[model samples]
Target chain A: MSENRPLILVTNDDGINAPGIRALIEVMNTLGDVMVVAPDSPQSGMGHAITINDTLYCNSINVIKDAPHKEYSCSGTPVDCVKIAVNEILKRKPDLCVSGINHGSNSSINVIYSGTMSAAVEAGTQGIPSIGFSLLDYSLEADFGPSKKFVKAIAQQTLKNGLPKGVVLNVNIPKLNASEINGIKICRQANAHWEEKFDKRTNPVGRDYYWLSGEFVNDDEGEDTDEWALRNGYVSVVPVQFDLTAYRAMDELNSWELK
Target chain B: MSENRPLILVTNDDGINAPGIRALIEVMNTLGDVMVVAPDSPQSGMGHAITINDTLYCNSINVIKDAPHKEYSCSGTPVDCVKIAVNEILKRKPDLCVSGINHGSNSSINVIYSGTMSAAVEAGTQGIPSIGFSLLDYSLEADFGPSKKFVKAIAQQTLKNGLPKGVVLNVNIPKLNASEINGIKICRQANAHWEEKFDKRTNPVGRDYYWLSGEFVNDDEGEDTDEWALRNGYVSVVPVQFDLTAYRAMDELNSWELK
Candidate 1:
């Protein structure tokens, strides 16, 4: 390995202007030549979706004044942004791809709904070492000071030693002061879910309408879960992969009669 | 279990008006008391997306004349429709929630990008037995006749023998005549991906734009994979679950030093 800097590609589900991505970009700048190709708008629950039905438009944007890194805002999903970056924008395959420093937690089952992690997963599918970072706070004005140093440390370690093949990291930082942060924990996604409740209403034209509302219910009491780590004020890092196969159940499923 | 028929919830990624769903509705009608709450428009690549950022609209529709099923057109993603149907529409947890008979194959990696599978996954999360059905063809005029009996059989089996907890089935029917089908094969999702190629172009004002394009590439040569089942003209049933944990890599990741 050369002593020279690594090439890092940074993107997020939150729009480029979101403070979360800005903080992530700042951290990446200290480690490598960073390229930013992120969505033009918030793409929060996009999962692994790509913009197959529309034309994509990407334009160079000047976000940080006098910063050497290049940035682009693309009219696509987070996964689309990664595809365009690797296949069209970037001149070479990046040494690493980091998505988010997102404004909300993607711990537990929420990872399935996350656009932030989807970007990282998309990179992993293309054989790039990647990590997606999220904070437990969802507010636009949420403080990111607690996460900066930890984010930098994780990114540096990942750059120094690449991740396992076909695996990406889903890191969720707790919302706390830097001094109060209880360090990092390698954890698994908790078995948690949103208990959905729809608020029903009638439109002005007498049509019934509803608004989706939910309460997060974490039933898993495992200490080695991302939810536990975040709840206890530690940054949680879960090694995630794109393969959806439940390998343990394969034999059982195969034994079932098809007729 | 009572001798009385089961109550089934039916939906699809394609809108309530799509011919593919209409055919599925017809097949499901013979099974039980079917209630359809599906999106009002096509949502092909919606993935596990939900309509959290917007208000939802669901109106009872009289789409199919003389059909003995309750149907509603929803202004939301497939996942959203499932949420609304379960939380607001249904009096109790459904015996079965079947999505699709979709116009395209959601076998292998396509499962991660499918709204149909998302609907089924959503139902599974709620402890409901669910399945997402798809055809190997993408034509709007594709025939569902060949796979109707198989689809009914699978749904009936799921209703009769409850799925092992926390699992949902992703069933893909090969596009072939009934007599030509080589029965069903319970399989695992193959290691497959789309080799993305962005179609670059210049707009009327000479700004560079792109259209996302790709070709499916199957890397797994295993005969027990979903890809192989489809290739051999057999219906592929992959038992899928939403827990995205890579358990084998957990220990290796835990060994990494965070400090």
Candidate 2:
């Protein structure tokens, strides 16, 4: 709504210091007045966790040298960063809120466990136009050059056209180089799951512990799915909503006739 | 799918020691071979979170004295409990997975931040029939007696006729006694949100910190909502799904025509 460049709030689950967020900050610097309020530590799978039982600490930081954007580091989850940014930090609600450029994919069922997408969803819940971006690669030094144009295009388009109510974009970029990329595809979330294979190990003190490991399984054969789009070398954009109600099944449930 | 007693996986975000899960366990014991796998500590706002970067420990515990049900206390989030229960503990997939009888409500927008509902959603993702139950009361000593019959009936119905794929239930019982309570109503999640007020305070060391405090704001006046049903003394049952995809927005997004 700004006559000047729109005020964009930038954040991520990989912490303010992560290269993923830095790449995002670089992109937003060209777009608008950016203010980043992100977690001080990596909060990869924190989901929609807030600092209820504990206290939150948000401190101003310089994530990039002579950065155009002002930044703050928060001592909470990605969702907490968005809450504190909206309620306490910013003087006004931001024109747009974009989370991530995350180190790993938040496609398909990963969106549920994603701290990145949760931040975006939190922003959407607060009635802000928001988007979450993630790369298929988990490497810290993954190539982000190919994603720059697409990311900016998406953000620019969102700013111009505006997002629908109760909806946010979950954009996942493939790891392919710029030349190998096949452009963006707006798609639905695939019916996929993580086949959890917990690595059970015994501690030196005789205590047994397990580390969560998993293999991504895309069971949905639909060509219109985010999984299919990502697999086919395109950046996948799936519009996500926070309303969990399964309206399609409500009639069936009503048929139960519970007393 | 068992020809004998159906296998039920019972879990809660309030940890294994909480009274809510105990009430849930008691109800499930009468209906099936109940196996309780819950968090070792309270994980109220851990929505869809799993322990990825850290280690998890799941230990057998006896919460109820002379209990018929088998229970395991997991050192992870509520979603982790479900993952561990399904993968590491149970020999076969559970017939039904029930999470919570939560001390507090998981109604409307609260479901997005709820660890209890996250467990149920996780089960739903794995193609299991799941339900998350909560009471409007937040007290540890709140009477769960009023909820027992309704909870049993719903669970019985779910067992008799399985939930559709990717669908789960979010059931919130009102605070009234059993006789005072009206019948269950299948409803939609109300468009509601918390009006967050962060209590900013200086720590003993003089640095500032904030505690998240909020009041539930129900702006939606729709009578068909869960909020309406709960406020009118009826138990609200909302069939929830894990498909976050906003299918309605796909066409508009496809029009973007990114280069």
Q: What's the lDDT for all of these models?
A: 0.89, 0.92
Candidate 2, residues A31-116, lDDT tens digits: the string is 99999999999999999988889999989987557877799999999999999999998888899999999999999999999999
lDDT of 1 by residue, A1-259 (tens): 2237799999999999999999998898888999999999999888878787889999999988898799999999999999999999998899999999899999999988899998998898888999999998999999988799999988888888788877899999988989999999888889888899788888799877888999999989999999998989889988887777666666766666665
**Reference-based TM-score of each model:** 0.97, 0.98
Distance (Å) between predicted and true CA of A167, model 1? Answer: 1.5
- Model 1 regions lying over 4 Å from their true place: A1-3, B1-3
Report the C-alpha lDDT of model 2 over B21-92, residue by residue, as the tens digit.
Answer: 989998998999999999999988998888888999999987667777789999999999999999999989
Which residue pairs does candidate 1 place in steric collision? none
iRMSD, model 2, in Å: 1.0
Pairs clashing in candidate 2? none
> What TM-score, to 2 decimal places, does chain A of model 1 have?
0.97
Give candidate 2 regions above 4 Å deviation. Answer: A1-3, B1-3
